[model samples]
Target: MNLNGTAALVTGAGRRIGRVIALALAERGADIIVHCYQSRADAEETAGQVNRLGRRAMVLSADQRDWNAVESLCRQAWDTFGGIEVLVNSAAVYRRTPLGDIAESDWDEMLDTDLKGPFAFARFLGPRMKERGCGKIISISDTAARMIWPGYIPYCVAKAGVDAMTRGLARALAPEVQVNAIAAGTVLWPDGFDAHQQEQALGHVPLRRAGSPADIARAVCFLVEHGDYITGAVLPVDGGRHLEG
Candidate 1:
């Protein structure tokens, strides 16, 4: 993957880690398709940053939980950019649902957005990339999938599914499209976390520090550019937190 002048689509790219990934790709000279569900203003801002980097950019909105919307997103990206050479499935939702209070809707939302959404994107765009005989797909997974998280069963399960999807898609689309994942840990503290909670979270990491979005972005860049022989790998960008257990 040369990355230069390639077309890349990053879901949930309106903000947070996704935004960083989109900007990093654009910095490497890839045209960006910034996908968002509700953060249109943020998505537009990301597109502006990409353009300022001297790369082409387009903002597209789609509900990843909707199969039809996912399909439509692929179609629109292809229609606008001819074809996407890189697909980064970064869209996801996280919620703290304790076991006793878990609802059916909570499970559905978690699995649909975090797991099925990436699967749908890969399912639809994979064959086309296969026909072209070269492409890259990276899913954003989580370290929680590899460890037990008391109040986030649904999120953990969904990310585990993403790990499985990455391996399965790698084999299914092998010899052409490479599929991989980034299992991150404590990269960005979510809103509502108090200083004490944040400290407790960081305490588990062997590095004794939190990771930045740029850390994940750099891993994405490596997979997109230098990882020619790498596929089906779930690289951990967790600052050694996964090593704790």
Candidate 2:
């Protein structure tokens, strides 16, 4: 994909890693549809940045877990841009839910947001892309999807589902729309983590350091701009952390 002037939708684009990815796409000449759940202010700010970069941007709000909202968002994006050539499923909820005390609501929230959101977006937008005969869908996955994280079982399961969804969608949409995922590791330290927890997390990384949002953003750019023949791939932008035991 050339990326220039292509319409791209990035979910959870209001802040953090999602924000950087949105900006990266804008910088590369792609028009952005920035989606946020509650951070309207932040989403607007991101749109402003995209506009300043000389790319068109619009901010939209929707709860990804709501199928009706997801459908409406897809319709709105199509109505606004005429068509969407790229979709980034970056919206997710990450939290530690100890297995011993895990609640139904907790599991549902994590799975619904982290896994079902992407599934819903892809379900709604995929056929349109198929009709057009070209598109790219990039999902945000995590290293924990493939590893054991005792305190975050639900999150891990959801991400693992994301990885599966990426591969399945790739096969299903092949010869037309490309689907792929990025499995990231130790990028941004969650605000909830204490210093000791952060250190312990970092210690597992073979690179012995945390990565930046820009690192993940660059991977997204690569997939968007140059990954024409790549599909069903889970590119690990983890500074080699997935290699650790």
Candidate 3:
């Protein structure tokens, strides 16, 4: 996919890694649609950055829990940009749902945002892109899915589902739209991680260091802009974290 002049919708692009991915795509000449739920202000800031890079930008807000949100987002993106050639599922929820005390709401939030939400976007846009001839869909998964954490069972499960869905979508959208995922490592510490926990987590990685948001962003760029022959693959951008086990 030629990112030049292409339109991409990056969900959860309000801040953090999502913001970085949005900027990276814009810098490469792709216009961005910054999606956010509570971070509308941050998303607007991201859109401004994209415009300063000489690429067009738009801000769209939607709750990932709702099924209608994806349809609305795709419809507006098509109307505004004529068509979106790329889709990035960067929005996610990472909550600690330990066993024995897990609530149903916790499971709902994690699966809805991390798994179902991204799947909805791809399912809605995959065929559209295939019809248009070519497209790319990239989701931000996590290494924890492979090495599940005791305290984040729901998060790990949702991310695992993302990997599974990535493979499924790849075959479903084959011949034109490429569907893939980036299983991120310890790029940024989750909100509640203590220093000790962070250190313990990094110890498993051979590199023994945390990766930056740009690391994942670059992987996203490679998948969308340079990965013509790649699909259904979950590329790990985790400082060798996944390789440890």
**Best-fitting candidate, measured by TM-score?**
1
Task: Report lDDT (CA) for all predictions.
Answer: 0.94, 0.93, 0.92
CA RMSD of all predictions = 0.7, 0.9, 0.9
TM-scores for all candidates? 0.99, 0.98, 0.98
Q: Top model by lDDT, which number?
A: 1
Show model 2 residue runs off by greater than 4 Å: none
Order of candidates by lDDT, top first? 1, 2, 3
Q: How many residue pairs clash in each candidate?
A: 0, 0, 0
* Lowest lDDT 10-residue stretch of candidate 1: 141-150
- Which runs in model 3 stand beyond 4 Å of their true positions? none
lDDT for each residue of candidate 1 in 74-177, tens digit (9 for 90 to 100): 89998899999999999999979999999999999999999999998899999899999899999989999998598999999999999999999999999899
Candidate 1 matches the true fold with a TM-score of 0.99
How do the residues 1-245 of candidate 3 rate in per-residue lDDT, one tens digit apiece? 77998999999999999999999999999999999999989999999999999999999999987879878987898789989899999999887787989999999999998999998888788889999999999999998889888889999999999999999999989989899999999888878889999989889999989999999999999999899999999999898988887
lDDT of 1 at 122: 92
| Stronger candidate by lDDT (1 vs 3) | 1
